[model samples]
Target: QVALRCGANDFGGTLMEENISRAAGAQYGVSLSVEEIRGIIREIGRIPKERNTLYEILE
Candidate 1:
């Protein structure tokens, strides 16, 4: 997760496809997409750059 923030990005979701492990519980909130993660990074005053799964620069 720290890598995501350092790369001007944010994590979207986990492969598990649920929020049960989070403090809010499974019924609270939904997962985010890549686009949403980008938006969040921007909102947090980051550049919001894209990267591949292997961490290669995309844009």
Candidate 2:
């Protein structure tokens, strides 16, 4: 959340096997489910959208 206040805008989705962090031995989980991400964004009063590779909003 502090990162959001510091101007981090994009939160990546849960549609992939994000094992690179675990491969690097990080303690956190690899990814968040899409609904979880959306909830977090809404908790901070922000809108969440599903965007395409070209950054077009899909939802």
Best by TM-score: 2
User: What local distance difference test score does each model get?
Assistant: 0.60, 0.70
Clashing pairs in model 2, backbone N/Cα/C closer than 3 A: none
Error of 1 at 48 (Å): 0.9
Candidate 2 per-residue lDDT over residues 1-59, each given as its tens digit: 66666887764433455665766798875666778877877888888788777878995
Off by over 4 Å in 2: 12-15, 23-28
lDDT of 2 at 27: 85
TM-score of each: 0.43, 0.65
lDDT of 1 at 34: 68
Candidate 1 overall lDDT versus native = 0.60
lDDT of 2: 0.70
**Residue runs of model 1 more than 4 Å from their true location after superposition:** 1-24
TM-score of 1: 0.43
